[model samples]
Target: MADPIKDTRRMIAEMQPRLHPGKYVFCSGIRDDLAADVANVAKGSFVEDEGMSFIIPQEETDRLGIAGGVAMRQITLMVRSALDGVGLTAAVSSALATHGIPANIVAAARHDHVFVPADRAEEALAILLARQAEAQVGS
Candidate 1:
């Protein structure tokens, strides 16, 4: 099997994700302190099978006084890694951070999802593309 981290460059395309930044929200049935507290809903249900759970930015969450909450943003790249390694996350995060882009990483069994701010979507794509190119050239 190909290494998840090493093979990611070939598995996914570098995309310039377009974002329509507006009011939005999502809910996870499984609530935990680690998850963002955007809003509290007494009704409705969430699907836990979906690898990561997060509520997008919504007016209700604002009204509920959620803090440390991140606004809905764009994800320039979607990558999958069968190998769940902490080292890969840190390395990828460090690469993005070096370019002054904040990456919110969520790891699922089959892949790792990275969410970047809508405003920085273009720059984020450039960074990832460059990284992919570098990997290609090096190999």
Candidate 2:
């Protein structure tokens, strides 16, 4: 993988956003009995006051009998952005918000994933593409 991008403009300019297939929903599980199941199934998770908030496949919610809200789709930013990179999330969210789309971002080892309402996934991808195009010119 290439060096993680640090410059905001360059990061945006090179970010090739691609939609990840399938729908995902957040589920909460904190019981000791649930740890293995969650660790095996959750695509990602974050600790929350109520429980362990897990982003798992929508199907798992049904299987696990857990309540989930707002089906979301992931848009993976191909740029390998530094974990401490500045402004990338703000730029992404700002661009999406301008079009009335909400973005929930997760930064992993190699890329940043943006989760948008499933219904707006395609539109969000387009907006990111346009933002990247504009940034390319600026870079």
Task: Name the regions of candidate 2 deviating beyond 4 angstroms.
Answer: 29-35
Q: Please, what are the lDDT tens digits per residue for candidate 1 over residues 1-139?
A: 4445444444433222233345333444434563444324421223567644455555655555544245545442344454543355565577789988888765655555566765676677567666766656655
Worst 10-residue lDDT window for candidate 1 reads: 37-46
TM-score of 1: 0.53
Per-residue CA lDDT of model 2 for 51-103, tens digit only, reads 67889888887776667789999999999999888998999999999999989
For model 1, give the RMSD to the true fold.
7.3
